[model samples]
Target chain A: MSKTVLSTRGLRKTYGKRDSKFDALRGIAIDIHQGESVAIIGKSGSGKSTLMHLLALLDKPSRGEITLHNHPTANLKARQLNTIRNKEFGFVFQSFFMNSNDTVLNNVILPLKIAGVGYRERRRRAISALKTVGLDDKRNNKANDLSGGQKQRVCIARAIVNDPKIIFADEPTGNLDSATGEKIIDLLFRLNQEKGITLIIVTHDHELAAKCSRQINIKDGRIVADSANETLEAENDDKEEFKDNDMDDMLDHQHPTHHINVDEEEE
Target chain B: MRMLDVIYDANANLLRNKLRSFLTILAIFIGSFSIISTSAIQAGVNDFIDSQVDSYGGEGYLAVVSNDSFDALDGLQNGMGNNKTPIEYNPDKIQTGMSPLTNEQIEKIKKIDGIDGDSLAKEQTLDITYVTSEETDKKYLIAAEALPPGNVKVSLVTGKQLNLQADEYQILLEEKYVNALGYDNDNIIDKKVQLAVKDDYTHKIKTFAAKVVGVIAPSVVSMGYQYTNNKLADDIYQENIKYYPEDMKNKTYAVAVNYDYENYSADEIKDKLEEIGLSAMTVEDIIGTIKSFFDIILTVFRIFGYIALLAAAIGIINTLFMAVQERTREIGLDKALGMSSKRVFLSFSLEAIMLGFWGSVFGIILSVIIGNIANAVFHAPGGFLESFPTFHLVVYTMSDIISVTILIIIIAFLAGTLPARRAARKNPIDALRYE
Candidate 1:
C-alpha cells in the first residue's frame, strides 16, 4: 500500500538495425513502491540489467512508457533527468566503477559534486556516508589500494551520499566472497529498514533474491514471476491509487515524511 | 557540474599520465619558442631601422641632384652603359665626375610649387684637413659636411642640436670623436674645436674655431661623419677653394630641400623634380633595401615557426585522443552518475587548453632568459654589436607575448574538439562495457 516510486507499462528496448536487430527487453511492466526492498532476479542475457537501466533513466526505451511518480518521463529534458539522477537516485555497480587514483572521500562525493553542491556541505555528507559503510577511517586512502570488499563498501558509501530516495544496486556483491558478500547484504538491508529508502537490486543469486521483501523473476526479457502480483492486482481495482497528494509529496525534494508514511502503510 | 570543478579535474587528469602530457607540451614549447623568438628579433630590427630613418633627414626631406649626375652614377653602376666596346667619344656627353647643378636649375627648383624654398640649403662638402680639440694636441684627419635641411633629427648622446643659421661656427662631434678629443659627452658641449682647411695651390692652412653643440650617437646613416652648421661649413668650403679658379668656385653638386609631404607623396614630388631635369632621393630610397633584406629573412623564420606550431597542434590532437580512449570506463561512470555530455566535453577541452597554457608559459620563460643572455653577450666587449649601445638583439614586447599565447590556446582548443566530441557522444553502457 506504499506509494509507487517507479512504474512502467509495456517497456521495450532494441539494439541495432533491422538486418542485425536484437531485442534486449521485449516487454516489461512493473510498479516499484517506496520503502519496499525489491529484487529483479534473472540469469545472464535475461535483460534484467536493461530493465534496471530503463528504470534508472540511464537509457531511453524503444517502446512503451516509463513514469516516475505517475509523471511520464518521455517529455523530460536531459537536464531534468540528470538532476533527478544526481539528487533523487543512487547507484551501486557490480565492478565498482571508481576513480581509482582518487581518495575514498572524493569518490563518495561524486554524486553531490555532480549536483553542484558546495564544497563544505558535500564533504560533510560524504564523510557521513563513509561512516555508514564503516570506512570513515579510510577516507583518505586511494580507492585502488582498497580490498575488493572494502571497495564495494566505498561504492555503497558513494551511492548513498546524495541521500537518494532509491538505490539501484546492480549485483551489489557479485565480486565478493560469501563472507564479505553477507556483510554487504546485511548493510544494504539495514539502510532499507532504518532509513526506509526503496531498494531495487538486480541479481541472479537466489539467496540474495530471497532476502528482499519481494522478487520479480525475468526470462528472455519478460517477467516470468512476481511475488507481489496479487498486491498489484488488488491495487489495479482502484484506478486512482496514485493520488495528487502522493505525487506532490514524492516530487518534493525535501520530502521528510516518507519513513513515517511507509511504516503506516506496512502496518 | 561547476566549471571550476571541470577545470580542476582536467588538470588532475593530465597529471594521471605525466610522461605523455610532458612530451606533448614539449612539442608545443618548441613551436611557441621559435615563434616568439622570431617576433622579438623582428621587433628589434624594426626599432633600429626606424631610428636610422629618423636620422637620415626624416619625412619630407630629399637630396636633390641634376638628372645628368644621376644618369652618370647609374651608368657607372650598370658597367658604363650597353656599349660593350668604346666606339666614339662624344665631347658634349663626356663627364669627368658628378655634373654640378647649374645656377639656373637651382633657381627653378626653389620656385617649385610644393617645395619649401626657405628650407633649401646647398650641400657644402667641407674638406677639413685636420681637426683638433682645445684639450688635445693631436690633430685627427676628419671629414665634415653641412647638416641637411628639413626635419633633420640627429640622435645625440648628450647635448643640444646645431643652430643652422647662427653666425658663430658650431659642430656636432661623433661619439668616437668625443673621447679621442679628450672630452666626454657631457663636458664636450659648447667646447671649442679647431678645423684646419689646406689650400692646395699655396699649401697654406687656415684654422677656424668652432663650438661643439652635441655628440652624435653611432648610427648607420651618419657613419662617423661630423655634422657642421651652415656658417662653419661655408667658411671651411670657402677657405679650401681659395686656390680654385673663378669659374669653378660656385659649382654645386647637390642641394637638400623639404616639400609638402602631407599633401603630396614623395613620388609626386620626385615627378615634379623630374619635369625640371632634376632628380631627388628620399630617406626611404636610401635605406629601403636594408629594411627589405631584414624583412625577407624574418618572414622566412616566421613561416618556419608556424609550421612547427601546426605539428604541435597535431600532437595535442593525438594526446587527447589517446586520453579519451584510456579513460573510456571513467567517462562512462561519470556519465552514468549524471555528469552531462557538455561537462565531459568541457573537461577534456580544458585539459588541452591547460597544456597550451603551460607550454606557452614555459616557452616565454625560456625564450626571455635566452634572449637576455644573447643580448648581453652580443653587447659585451669584442662582440660585433659592441659599438651599438642602444640596439637590442631581441626585443620582447608585451603585445607579442600575449597574442602568441592566445593564438596557441585557440589552436589547442580546436585540436581538442575532435577527441572531446568523441568522448561526449559515447554511450554510457558501451563505454562501461569497453575493456
Candidate 2:
C-alpha cells in the first residue's frame, strides 16, 4: 500500500460566540493515501466545502488536528501554512477564479511566481502546465476571452504549475456541461495516475464520484459511507484496461521531454 | 513571496484602473505643488532681505548718537534706495546742543576695546553753487555734509575714495550733482570747487579752495548726500561753531562708532552702547523686525499647503479603503495562492507609496515649470513682479524639494496603513465567498 499522505482525527469547526454559536463541521476522522483519487460527496452545506478549506489550510479548524505525511498541521502559523500550501497543495475552485485581466500564460505562472521561482523557469513551467490542459495554443489570450471550459482549463493549469504534491479540487467541473466536465475530470485523473500525485475532490455529482478510486459520503460533516469503486477493484485484479492515448502525452514536468508529445496529441 | 513579485502584481492591478489612479495622483499633486510654491516664495523673501541690508553698505557697523536725535535716520527713509534724497540735518544745532559728546566722552569710547574708532558726526554749511552746463545760468545750491569714514559704501565715478586722515581739503560729489552742478560728462572727479564758510573765532568769511576727489553713485538706501572725512569736518566745525554761545559750544559733535561686526553681535554691541547712556542704530535693528514679520507670513502661508497635504493623505486612505473593499476576492485569492498576510500588507502599502511618489514627482515637475514661469514673469527687466519687494519672485532650495517629496510619501504611507492591515488580516474563506 502507498503511504498515507494526509489524515484528520476528530476534526471539528465552529463559528460565532456563546448564544450565536454554530457548528460547521462535526468531529470526524479519515485517512487519504498518496496517489489515491478520492471523492467527498455531500449535499450543499453538508460541511464538505468547510472540510476542504481546512484540509487546504485556507482556514483554521476550531478543534482537532490535521497531519500531512505525519507532520501535524493544526497549529502551524499562517506563514508556515502558506508555505505548505505553496509547496505541497494545489486547489481548483468551482467558479474558475482566473484573473480576467491577465493573459492565460500569466494566470498559470502566478503560483510559481508566489513561490519565488525564477521568472524564466516559472514561464517555462507555466507553458508546460498550459500544454497539460491542452490550452498552450491560447496562452497569449486574455483569461476572460476564453470560453467557460477553456477558463477552467486555465484554472487547472494554474493549480498544477507549481508541481504541488496534492491537488484539492472543489467541484472542479460544476460549471461545465457533461461533455466538457468529462474532459476536465479526465485531465485531472491523468495527472493523478501519471505523476502519483494525491487527488481529493468535493462534489455533488454521483457520476464524477463513481470514477474515483474511493468515495466517502458526508452528511452534517460526518462520514456516512466509505467504499472503493469497481475501477479500483478491477485494477487490483490487474484486469483494468488503460486505452487513453492522451495519457501518453501527459506532462512529465520533472523532465520536459514528455512535454514534446503535446503537438502529436493535437493531430 | 518575493518583494519584486508583490510590486509587479500591484502595478498590474493599478494599471487595470487607469482613471482612478490618475485622479488619486492628481490630489497628491495639488498638495505637493502648494508646498513647493510656498517654499519658493519664502526663499525669494530671504533674498530680498539680504539685498536690502546690503544696500545700506551691509549690517556690519552701528551708529551711536546722543539723545533721540538719531530718530530721523529711521523715520526719514522708506522703500528701497533707488534714488538719493537730501538729509535734513543741521550741524550747528547738533554741535551746540546741550548733550554733545565732550572730549572726555570720546576718550571713554576709545577705552572700549571692541570699539575700532569713534568720530564726531558733524555737518558743515558751505556756499557751493554751480550752473548746469546745459542751462549755463541757474545755479543749484549744493549742501555739503561730513561723516567719519568707516562704514559707508561709496562708489566712485572717476576719482578715488577720500583719505579720512588727510589734511588736504577735498570733496566727493554725489552722482546727481555731477549733472545738476553743470559739469557735463563724467570728468568731475578731479575738478576744483569753491566753498566759503564763516569763521567763528575771527568772525570773518574764510574762503577755501577744495578739489573733487570722488563722486558717489545713486544708492538704494541713502542718496544725494556729499561725504567728507572727519578732517574736513573739524575744519568746518571750528570755523562755523567755535564762537557760539558758551552753552552751545559743547554741541560741536555727534559721536558715531564703527566696530568689527564679526567680533560682536548686533544685540551685544547695542547693549554695550546703551550701557554708556547712549542710543545705537544698525541696519539689522531696522531689518530684523521686518524679518520676523515676514516669518509670520511665511508660517501662515504654509498652513494652507499643509491642509492640502492632509486632504491628500485622506484621499489616499479613501482610495485604498475602496480598493480593499473592491479587491476582497482578489486578496482572498492571493492568500489562497500562498501569499502571506505580511506580503499582502506590504504589497498594498507599496501601491500607495508608489502613488504618492508619482504624485510628488508630477507635482515637482509641474510646479517647477510653473514656478520658473512665474519667476520669469516677475524677474524680467520690465516685469511688474520685480516692482514688488523681491526682484526674483520665486526660489527653490534643495531641502525644500526633498522635504516636500519625503513628507508626502510618509503621509501617504501612513494613510495606507489602515487599509493595508485590513487587507492583510482578511479571512480567506469570507473573502473568497465575497462576490
Best by lDDT: 1
Tens digit of lDDT per residue, candidate 1, span B18-89? Answer: 999999899889888988998898888778877777766578889998888765644454455576665444
Q: Write the per-residue lDDT of candidate 1 for residues A48-157, one digit (tens) a residue.
A: 99999999999987665778988888778888888888878888988999999999999999988888898999999999999999999999999999999999999989
Tens-digit per-residue lDDT, B126-159, candidate 2: 3333223333455455566664346565555467
DockQ score of each predicted structure, in the order shown: 0.52, 0.52
Model 1: lDDT of residue A254: 39
Q: Estimate each model's TM-score.
A: 0.87, 0.75
Task: Report clash pairs, candidate 2.
Answer: B81-B220, B81-B221, B84-B223, B95-B251, B95-B252, B96-B251, B132-B182, B133-B182
Identify the leading candidate in terms of TM-score: 1
Listed per model, the TM-scores of chain A against the true chain A are 0.86, 0.84
| TM-score of chain B, candidates 1 onward in order | 0.87, 0.67
lDDT of 2 by residue, A193-264 (tens): 998878999999999999999998777766677784222222112111132123423421233222222222
CAPRI quality of model 2: medium
